[model samples]
Target: MFDIPQLDLKGKVSDAEWQTRVDLAACYRLVAMHGWDDLIYTHISARIPDSEHLLINAFGLAFDEITASNLVKIDFQGNIIDENCPFEINPAGFTIHSAIHEVRHDAMCVLHLHTNETIAVASLEQGLLPLSQYAMFALASMSYHEYEGLAVNPAEKLRLQQDLGMKNFMLLRNHGGLTVGKTIGDAFMHMYDLTRACQIQLQIQGSGQPAVLVDQEIVDGIRAQANIVHTGLTGGQKSWPAMLRKVYRTDPHFAR
Candidate 1:
């Protein structure tokens, strides 16, 4: 469907980088499968292990079209590291991911999407109410960033970092949602909880009925409870394999 050239990096790159590429590619496919992709707009980025360079989608390819080797590698300044890569990344798209990646060393993967439900919830003054169990997980470590037109300015990076602080989830007011995790799976899981919370919130509001919010105590303690439930195996680590399986069943070429 697309005229993008294919490059095989399986043997060309280190085993660790190859794994990151495959996982990031699978993450893109999963986002598309969930109908959360905004064409080629939003980005999901992964830091190259033990390196300053990161991997992101080659700008023009749709989520489903992304393959492991086709992912673009770049430095913190958004310069494409591979001269042979026939794709140019969207500078504006990288602005948000780059900002977060710069300050959050623990954030190995950063996922951002512009789903309608997230935009609606973020636009509200209340912002991500603890109305569902999903919301509780999100509210446990959520932050909000006021939309500042397009996030193209380098100056905006500092403010975004400051607003995000140590939070894993961020609702970009009137914009979209962003999640950062120590791994690609963790980032995807965070997005899942956040997107579902917004979807449920919209459904309840649209019904025009009074909504029941979760207790503040429960919301406050959700992290500890989640830790126990996911004990030796975190939610993402457990669920990611299933996610990979589903994606593979759909089309295994994402790993390329």
Candidate 2:
């Protein structure tokens, strides 16, 4: 029943920054629509194109409540860049998101979620298996980061960066899932494919029957073909327009 405070920066920011805000806000709304939101706990950070400043949701706002005008702009060290911004960034979210953004220069967006199915899969000792095509897609660029308590400590950044390497998808062991993209849409789609793969894995495991795993050679071939067709951020751009249309139909206020 809480109402978010009014935030209007329509004429204050540059055109590129405003568009980044809108896209990042739309990403939050899409995450909520997909039922991946964990109240106000999770975080999604997007870079401001050519700037070092990044956009993140205020710690207390629900994903659906996030609007373009409401996201806080912060620097790499988690300092609020906008003096007028009232809300503080989440400390833990900062430690996690900023670490990736600090080194992953090519990544424009970093999405971390704690959905039930994704957590379940992350808790598995064997990690995600390629039981389906969705799983294969995830396995293509996925890596695993061993969980280290609250992730608020700065020391954990080194290990996290090493574990993540150049992978786009990361399974935070005993924690949750992570996806980094050259664009917001790419990050969202990465999480979507990972979430689906986790759901399918859970369903298959629940059936108590032996599952057929895809051949590694075939999996590698398909991954190569996918790379050939979808290069860099182009993969996300292909479906981003449709995603924006879906978000607008669901609720246009996210872009406000």
Best by lDDT: 1
Q: What is the C-alpha lDDT profile of model 2 across 1-256, one tens digit per residue?
A: 5666888887789999999998999999999998999999999999998899899999998999999999999999999997878788899999999999999999999999999988999999999998988888789888999988998999999888999989999999889999999999999889999999999999999999999988878767766777777774366788888998999999998887
Q: What does candidate 1's lDDT look like per residue over 170-197, in tens digits?
A: 9999999999998999999999999999
Q: Which regions of candidate 2 are displaced past 4 Å?
A: 228-233
Query: What clash count goes with each model?
Result: 0, 0
**In candidate 1, which residue ranges exceed 4 Å CA deviation?**
none
- CA lDDT of 109 in candidate 2? 97
Clashing pairs in 1: none
TM-score of each: 0.98, 0.96
